[model samples]
Target chain A: MLYDVFISPFAEFEFMRRALIGSFALTIGAAPIGVFLMLRRMSLVGDAMAHAILPGAAVGYLISGLSLAAMTAGGLVAGCLVAILAGVVTRNTLLREDASLASFYIISLAAGVTLVSLRGSNIDLLHVLFGSVLALDDDTLLLLAWIATITLLVLAVMFRPLLLECVDPGFLRSVSRGGTVTHLVFLCLVVVNLVGGFHAMGTLLAVGMLMLPAIAARFWCAGVGPMIAAAAFIGALASISGLLVSYHAGLATGPTIILSAGVLYIFSLLVGPHGGLVRQWAPGRHLEA
Target chain B: MTFALRFSDLTLGYERHPAIHHLTGEVPAGDLLAVCGPNGAGKSTLLKGIVGILSPLDGTIERVGVGPREIAYLPQAADIDRSFPVTVYELVSTGLLREAGLFGRIGRGERTRIEDAIAAVGLTGFEGRSIGTLSGGQMQRMLFARLLLQDSPVILLDEPFTAIDDKTTSDLLGLIGRWHSEKRTVIAVLHDFEVVRKHFPRTLLLAREKVAWDATQNALNGENLLKARRMVEAFDTAAHACERAA
Candidate 1:
């Protein structure tokens, strides 16, 4: 029975396998970007960027009649551009960064909803926000694989500048030309990952997945390289565990994966090495002598 | 001897408000310069301006021959943005980014230099320790190690003595003196007039809108000294009034 429900089910149907593959692909793609986003304090932007894509997704559907990959692509490009433009406006104008982000995101969210409403009755706007993991198709799996590969490559190539800029913007500026431009590019890369993640993980889960592992891994160490590795491991593990839980319990895979990540975050909060509650609460572990 | 820093009519500030007006100064080779001022007198602002932290408003302020490759800056103790997850070793190693003299991999010679720099700052055993796990003095030492790795001919320090114990202060000043003996120029924005007289041969007093005074304590003993005293008293009175209002 266990073989039939768990092991043999993979052999019987393609959708179940596709669902797992799609989610894994998405995780691999978005995990590293998620880690860095948390470091940059750009996690909220990641979440907002994910939501920012919904109206674009709806608009793409109305134009293309529900080609998931094409619609998602449209949504991603629109969201990324909006994020960049908002950042630019914030820097150029008198408004503070977060305030500008709030202004742009609110308007984008409103516009996206209006676009979705105008698109037609066939499309469900809720599906864009929550994501439809069960509806994973071959094309989406391929797209996920492609995005994951691109993200890995981009990070590898620009690792030095990106990491340096994140850690020491002034230092990078002192060394490199137009350090601000380099920072913007990094932000854009993070936005791309979030938009790509929206395909299988959905907006909320996608953003949650980005931050949870990184924050949890802060309990492990204070080194950037190690922190990122730990975060990626936690993310991959949470994805697998979440998928398994959903497979067994008939729950929403995206939300379940998010819950798994949430568990890790909580664990890190209480048991993390840097500032864990357990360490603080232990008899001999308190900071003061 | 090369001019370590030569500022010609440099005007610098934040946003639109100018702090150090179109002023000029030169710190020749191997000299220890004490930049003095009352509260809000733009001493720190002048140091930052020299290091290109704040953009120059008008006129030319050149570091003479020093490019980005040749200057090390030790920021104010309170001004450091320290929310990073880095170790002392990591912080020092960043200094070698300019010093390594190459790319891709850091060579053995650079690594040896980094170790020596860390040792010089009395943080030999703490190189592997996380920066967040440091005391205020240790953090300053770690920053000094970073500056050492930069190995620049010119070092600009902004109020590096605040909150430090006197022992550490002397230890650090001794190190700065050693650099001067090695023919490296050190320019520091300082508050201690006593130390200024003892260690620094030349001192420049600033009052935001003016140079205020630029000479030794002997010059300060004359009319220049009385004017500087007035400036200092003005600053004290302003602080007391603000406190009462608060």
Candidate 2:
């Protein structure tokens, strides 16, 4: 009975193993990018970029019968376009950064819904929204591994610039000539990671996982290197816990992962030493006091 | 002590419209020179150009004490993003970057210097506190702490005394005096004639074109003061221009 119920559902399953590997890779690879996003206060951009992939994935699926390949390509194209447009508008106009992001998200949503409707997908599109852990296959798992490698490589190359830019852009400009190029490259990596994470975590959960763990890590860390490491650890833990819960309880995986990350975020928000909620619960929330 | 800075035919502007045209100036070492100018006279631009924050359209800016790796830049407190949740220690550690050299590690020696910088700025135990919670005075002091950590021979300050209480301003002024005594060349972009006369032995009076790049406050006569006042007022007016119109 135990074999039929618990062990068999998890151990005896190939799809489960693929899903496990994909989830682990996504969690490990995408977390450091989240720390930067939170530091830059551009968590909303991650959300918009995640959702921006939907129309691309939908359109690709509509045109081609292949599921994972078409969606990834389509998502990348859509996300990059939206991100560039947002960046240009923000740079050109006097509008605040948040306002520009909001405008871009609105446009991307409109475009995605229009295209998705055109694709005439009557099937459960939870893979794009909530993500399907069970649907992961050997091929998709291999692609996810590549995604992890590329994400880590891009992050490792741009890590210094990304941290500097996030902490003090003026200092970066004052220091080196390559600052502009490095910053643009980092943003491109952000777009790619958002797209890569979308397959397992879904748009909402991808953003949630990216931001929550990093925000939580801020309370525990003194320096940039430690913060990045802490954020990655938090992400990996949440992803593992989420997958385990999803497997044992027969619940959805994406929301479960996000919930775990979000819970950690709340813990940090409330109990963190520096910016923690419980610490700042009083008027002493003001750092000076 | 030798000459601190030399700007040779330095022209600076944004995109197309030139702000300061063909300006040449030099400062002797150990002198606090207040750069006073009329609004749109490019005082900030000049500061930016000399300090290598903003590249000049033409010509060169060379400084003696400021090596290729050493500089202490105190940007206007308002210009910094105070809303960020970084701790005082984290913010101050950035000053060590010049010595740490981007990818270089922050060793024990660097850590020791960071503590000294914080103490120099009179905020020793406040390292754990978040930067966002500091008052305007405390915030400026934190900036000073960071500058102290840089340990550079030349310090470039852009309107450090703006929008603060008289007490804080005067306290900072006294700190500047102590800094000057250390023989570091200090270039302060300021408006108050009283502070300039009391602190700076040299003055650079500018009006888009270089009007006076001479020594002593005596050069800042009534006419120069009038032009400087106009420029400073115009800048003060232009900043909130949108609200003033409404």
Candidate 1 global TM-score: 0.87
Candidate number with greatest TM-score: 1
Compute the interface RMSD for candidate 2: 3.7
* lDDT (Cα, tens digit) per residue for candidate 2, span B1-246: 368888888888766445777788678787788988766788888877766766787778887856533566766543455555568888888776656654687878888888888887778888988777788778888888787777777888889988778877887788788879998788898878788888888888888767777765565888766765654322232232122110
Across residues A1-289, which tens digit of lDDT does each residue of candidate 2 receive?
8565545655877876677677777766677777777777787777767767677776776777547788888878877777766666765668765787677767877887887677677745667777666677777677778877888887776666566666677765555555666655666667777666777777566777677788789987856677878887888777767766777887887888778888887887778786677767764544653
Clashing pairs in 2: A269-A277, A270-A278, A287-B133, B38-B231, B39-B231
Question: What does DockQ give for each predicted structure?
Answer: 0.24, 0.21
Worst 10 residues of 2 chain B by lDDT: B237-246
Give the alpha carbon lDDT tens digit for every residue of B116-152 in model 1: 9889888888877877779998888877787777778
Candidate 1's DockQ is 0.24
Off by over 4 Å in 1: A1-6, A89-95, A117-122, A164-178, A268-274, A283-289, B68-70, B77-83, B99-103, B209-215, B229-246
Worst 10 residues of 1 chain A by lDDT: A171-180
Question: Which digits, one per residue and each the tens of the lDDT, describe model 1 over residues A180-201?
Answer: 6756676676666666667777
